[model samples]
Target: MEYVFTLKYQLADEDRDHEQIVERLFEAGCDDATVGMGQPGRIALAFTRDAADAWSAIHSALQDARKAMPSARLVEAGPDFVGLTDVADLAGVTRQNMRKLMLAHASRFPLPVHEGSSSVWHLSDVLIWLSGRGSYPISAGLVDIAKATKQVNLAKEARQIEPRFNRQLVPLLA
Candidate 1:
């Protein structure tokens, strides 16, 4: 049986660079995927089961792509996190800028549940959030083979994106 891995993505105002977005998706193993129609910031990538499986092989591609850039953290789309980092790995930012953007974003994260005495985000929440772009500002990195089994609340959040369940991978956006 062939599985269609439909990758649906939304762009924030800051992510206006189409080249960058394409590069990121390509590195994420969406190369050769046919683009389905959507709003300007949103796109649907249709991939064959074989290509989707390559996700695991190219897991580290995102981090590798971001190696030269500072403040760039990986976002994931799967059952391994809530929202990941609050900070963007960009240059020429000041202390005040960091505090301003990051501070509010932390609280914006979905309520993390308690595992024992510690509060940790669940991979399940991350997956659900990815399924529904009801939660924005979520991100992930390319998959890492060595650490494929390991689930880091933030790291895995970047490497893999949770996909839509419906036949058409479009966000309800309500």
Candidate 2:
């Protein structure tokens, strides 16, 4: 037999809410449960269980949920902007595929936005696009530009570091 168990936890400082977080866990086999607020900013939760074996099942579910949400604290901030990258992330698609999906479903979506001569899409518009033909649930939230910028910077730094190692190793090999 299987049972569900929920553990309440506090959110971290740099996190935001992720709406699809819970549903994804539930879909992954989290048993009957509910989550809410407790002291100050802490979270409270309830889980159901029919046997002791359910503990492992519950832990697996929680781990999956944590991976999806990452930060409990920010799970409530919601998405702000829907960039092409963000759309790709939510749809579990590649950038090229996302563009394909958009183009293939253009007639289904509302007219693309034209801002300063370039086409743009509102977050809501993307949600509509997902609703029309997507199999997964769409969550609302904006791309964290600051985080994205940092990632780009980190990638650039890594490329710079790679040459230093290669240059030093090339002498050793010769």
Candidate 3:
């Protein structure tokens, strides 16, 4: 299986030079990725890697990235965060249609991670829903990758949770 995913990071000052960073990443086994340095202090690696499973593909890429730039902070693992338009585009439907589906199936629709004027959902959630609905032509590989990315991203973010605070917070959250 070939998993396609993007890992975005906040680069440390030591990793400032674009050319050197690219070289280092390549030497560290991220040759499978296309590195993008579009924003200052940030780098994005888009990878299309072959592995037996989606988790292995993303896990290896993340490990390779760590070897290349140990100081870089992982910012996001995407296609994990998306809006209705993004889901619609992936499904080859209009944004309005996607919204209508959500509205029509409000009870079964996956909850958005963030709710605002611009709501965002984990792509795997929407893809799964569409697959259940049938006739969406959604790719199983993409859904698998999305699920793996979402899990990886959540685990990364979970590092920030203070165990004592969580012990207190978890009860309050309910």
lDDT, candidate 3, at 110: 95
Clashes of 1: 23
Each model's TM-score?
0.28, 0.31, 0.95
Task: Summarize candidate 2's per-residue lDDT along 1-174 as a digit string, tens digits.
Answer: 444333555666443343454565466454365755545545544555343343344445455556644565222111323467677777777878887876787777645534444455544557655756747555322122222222333343456567779788768955
lDDT of the structure predicted as candidate 2: 0.50
Name the candidate that leads on TM-score: 3
lDDT of 2 at 95: 71
**Residue-level lDDT tens digits of model 1 in 1-174:** 222333344555666666776676666555645654356766555544332333443343333324322233333332233223322222134536534643465665445645334344554443333335343343332222112322433444434545544323335522
Q: For candidate 2, report its TM-score.
A: 0.31
Q: Tell me the TM-score of model 1.
A: 0.28
Candidate that beats the other on TM-score, 1 or 2, i.e. the better one: 2
Ranking by TM-score: 3, 2, 1
